[model samples]
Target: MRIALATATGAAVLAAGAAITTVTPAYAAAAIADIKIDTTVSFIPPSGSDSIPFTVKVNSPYTGSKAPDIKAEFWKEGEATTSAGHAASVTALSDLANTTPAPTPASSVEVKGSIPVSSSDKPTTSTGKWTLKVSAYPDGSTTAVSSDTATFEVKAATRVTSANVDPDPVYLKSGKEVDVYAGFHLEKFGDEKITDVRLESKDSDDYYSLSTGLEADDSYHDSTSMDYSTSTGSWQLRISISRATKKYSFTKAFQVKKSGSSKAKSKITLYASPSKVKKGKATKLYGKVYRGSKAWSKKILKLYFKKKGTSKWKFVGYVGATSTGKYTKSVKPKYDGYWRTTAAATSLTSGSLSNIKFVDVK
Candidate 1:
């Protein structure tokens, strides 16, 4: 079959009997009539100087014995005829499977190359879409026999998303002194630097914690010592974060209760009847549950035991406090170990815990 070359049109004519087909896995079958071109990233950030890789696969099915030479060029969309607008240089591949740029190879073909990006291609400067044209030509001809064009968008520079806010509660009762921590997560996208990050106080409740810059992890965090006010109610903790192009406000409502308002103590204490005991002997454990000065009755308590040198505590048994606020549990010793107990929390009272007691096993 004799194929005609449209020298004047700059397009190589494909023989009717043999045609080049482009296979796009995602799209319907369409014949390119000669060559196929694909890319890794179709969207380039206008403000980014990142390189985009392209793969040009040419099916060597032609009447002539000479395999086609591939030419890869880049230009603004709709300007395929304007050769001066092209940005990539053709590099000959040492092997047929290679995909990067290099000088024309003497006997092989390379199809992979990257769209060059530099200071001039800064995202803000070019927000329009561009296209890459891959054309196949006979060894000595300038006319393209089969060609394919891949389009990509140069997107506007995108800023980081929103900043997230979080509060770490210290759970201090009124009249108790403690510290509270809050975090503002800053966002940094691409090569975009977080020029400035500041946590502005939105309310007095959040004034205790303040941050003006990024942490080691590019996050903003603040810690302040505070205590519950003299009442039982809710207060708003508000904070705002400011960045290059966006500001986000976050608020959280936390409850503050007067000291002694709840039956729970700042910390619970654990006690055992015998500090030392014989192996296989049962040791009794007890702890007083008090809400302020009043005994909190019938509270379920979990018992924990651990060996002196071990790092973890094992659950041994559970018991309930009596109406007089006293709780007791008896455990047979399997070995020498330390013992402790924790009172489960209730709606009206905070949980209590007993001190660790070591029992010597004989």
Candidate 2:
């Protein structure tokens, strides 16, 4: 009876040891989650406040209906252990119902948040890299199932301090052709450092795009021609300025009217040699072109004709002004019509069209 009792006691001790070993491994083998953080704005600006947009993804096969809680601590790159010291931190508790978990062997949840920041994170002059320490824990537990870190360079701020249009006139010249000159200055943009400058007309379907050329230090100017019809009244100059990192824009109001020639201002006049003429008779027509008080020598003048009581004008013929800014043409009238002329645009001028006059033809 004593031997049997000793064997029974040894067997009980061995069973207890086996049970302890099996339970230890089951707890150790339990799955933990994975963590990742992605940020939208890589750097914190110097002056203006901006959001550090980020998404945190939690991954684990056994992460059940309860979503994991996330926390982020920001610090300079070398100080990974500062989280325990209590640094700038943000926490988020994900509502499981609001999240969509991936349908796979492993579950994943996406949590999005933004950290508002400015020069307060670090000095604008500080070139050191920055890092964010991230951790994921079960919704109700302080113990983390996963942890990670992400690093980026915090760039300095760049801005457009001041912008102004340089004495742009309200009324630009328009006639046979239209030309406009626009200029601006960026007080902060250094000489020729500005990348692009654009001037657009809001009222006309015209492409008046231009860029700056050699000019006074730090000043920009542009000159280009546009198509402005009679229907064009007030205009808005849509101006855009850009650098490598930032862009700025604004608009200005203006007007356009038929002022003068493309090059020098000129007055165009047409004359019918005879006050009255019979139909089918050869009659002489003449015109003299004047630029400000002087003659616009040697330019083409195209004449147009319209039948009395008709609004449509038909092309009649063309003539070249003489050195004295005078031209004469002989045309045999076929019917009663109104006559007019316009100085055809040369490479130098937008051209000028004379006033319309009715010729009495019997």
Candidate 3:
């Protein structure tokens, strides 16, 4: 019985070795499926320089009983075929493979490596796709059996899209507070989805936040208002953006002018009934002109309507002040569209326009 058991064990070992040698698994050689790599890259670099990071991974066939050894490398495609040494050069990362035992049943062996930016690489250049190829080989095999490849892009070092500061050069008086808005503009890498933004403002804690990630198509307004009421002087606004590791910055100066008693503040009060007005309909419009000290007593107010399709405007009517500062005019719509009315307060210098009321007429 002992002899029979020993014979069976020896036969089993021999059979396993034979299978590993003879069976050519589907992914037993260098093939595209045996490799993995990161497709996205981000970073910031000095002007006239370029840097990129990438990862390469090796994978073995899932169905093979004998785990395979794998090696990875990078190569240039297209015109860059000759630039990348016509093949991957062992720099920071080298061709390495996993030589350990399999972890579980149906599990494939794997290895990974990261390629960092090297000083030797072309600065501000190497603008093409670099393919990462992963190769696999069976144990005791002298050549690669399968391989896979991935691609990456190398770009310029410093990238500045729209770099500017807001509240741009304003004046404020001592003990006079004024609110100012700052804005920045930019466009890069074919409409980049801005991620991870940072702002550094001058005066540190005294100022507000910075604005980044402005949409290429839409205007970006940062609500960073400044108040120079306490101290009258000049200040700077610094803005910075860290998009995907690429940094850009700009700054502007503003001032606070000294002033005295506030000017007589005059307001034009606009009164419009049926705040919601639809197109193509007659509606009554009212406007009142008021000054900081007293109400406007007499003024000639004109009513005009511009149809949606045409640029020419027709004078619908006019409201001449017969009483105090109040004036009213009733007019009908020419077409189904939006209309606006302006009240020139000849009586007072304060001119006011009523809120745009939408008039929808069927």
Candidate 4:
């Protein structure tokens, strides 16, 4: 009877062990392998209904039939722990169904969303760094499987809407001074201070620069001297506005016309002594410079030459005038070409070009 009872208990134990061994186990859940975030803009402006578009890409090894959901949030770098509504929320992306099955390394899907910002959401600082956090979660699940963070900046938007300089054609008499006025209208999106304002010349030879603080009414008025000794030509007034971290520049063209009777017109007379010369032989070229009827003595003149068939003139050399305003130079002929001399404008005299002379090479 004892042996029979033991045999019965052993059979029951064997049956329970067989049942436990045949039971199926649950598979592991899908997990995120990689994640990234991108945006079309680097910074957000403080005003208007600006929609900042962004894309979130999630790479996962999960072979599940349902795709994961993506969530994005934006906040100031140091204010991540602030109360609700302190950060901008990205609109939820549409649900995607995973098409890639098992045996593939990973499956990647992109989700897009946007964050709307306006003047009401302005930050405390003028310019501050902001962060965006993106997370991936399984379909219908609140727990995140992967996460990523990206950084950008939020800055004030500023621009020069309108600008102009008074007296487009500035008329100045010889040995006289003139006052030039500049005005600007700015369009700003947020609170930003103008640190400096400046007006300067584009030409190094006709150099004039002035810097001043911002005016109460945004009217930039300044004066500079333009006397008989000031070089005359096309001049540019460069307006530069400086902020804390950025500088904006604009330009306006203005002409300076000599108005006084002292202004003289210059002239040049040029000739090649030997009209025809053998190749590689020396020929003499002479010229005279005059300011009105008087000799413009001790002035430098530029000489240019062009081949018979070419339209562009090439600078060959320069010659200096003597005390009597006479200049002479000798050159070896290589090709049949036309020669001419030119005088640059001075403070009191206008520029002049000499008549073209042709030299024949034999």
Query: Each candidate's TM vs. the true structure?
Result: 0.31, 0.37, 0.38, 0.40
- Best lDDT goes to which candidate? 4
Task: Estimate every model's Cα lDDT from 0 to 1.
Answer: 0.53, 0.54, 0.46, 0.62
What does candidate 3's lDDT look like per residue over 275-314, in tens digits?
Answer: 4445545566676654333444555666666666777767
Looking at model 1, residue 182 earns an lDDT score of 53
In the predicted model 2, the residue pairs found to clash are: 262-350
**Model 3, residue 247: what's the lDDT?**
55
**Model 2 lDDT, full chain set:** 0.54
Q: Which regions of candidate 2 deviate over 4 angstroms?
A: 1-64, 73-123, 126-131, 142-147, 156-158, 174-197, 201-207, 211-221, 225-362
TM-score of candidate 2 versus the correct structure, residues matched by position: 0.37
Residue 92 local lDDT, model 2: 53
TM-score of model 4 vs. true structure: 0.40
Which parts of model 1 have CA positions greater than 4 angstroms off? 1-48, 61-65, 77-83, 89-110, 122-127, 157-362
Residues 19-84 of candidate 4 have per-residue lDDT tens digits of: 222221122233333223333333344235565566665555244445556666677546753443
Model 4 misplaced regions, further than 4 Å: 1-156, 186-204, 217-219, 260-338, 341-351, 355-362
TM-score winner between 1 and 3, please give it.
Answer: 3
lDDT of 2 by residue, 1-362 (tens): 00111122223323423422111211111122333333324444535566566666654513444555666667653556555523333445444353456433335555565555664555335344676656665666676545666666654433333343333433343445455666654443121145445554332333345674535555656766654343233345555544344444555665443344234356788778674788878778787886444566676788899988888999988888887788888887777888888876544345688876666778
- Between prediction 2 and prediction 4, which has the larger lDDT? 4
Ranking by lDDT: 4, 2, 1, 3
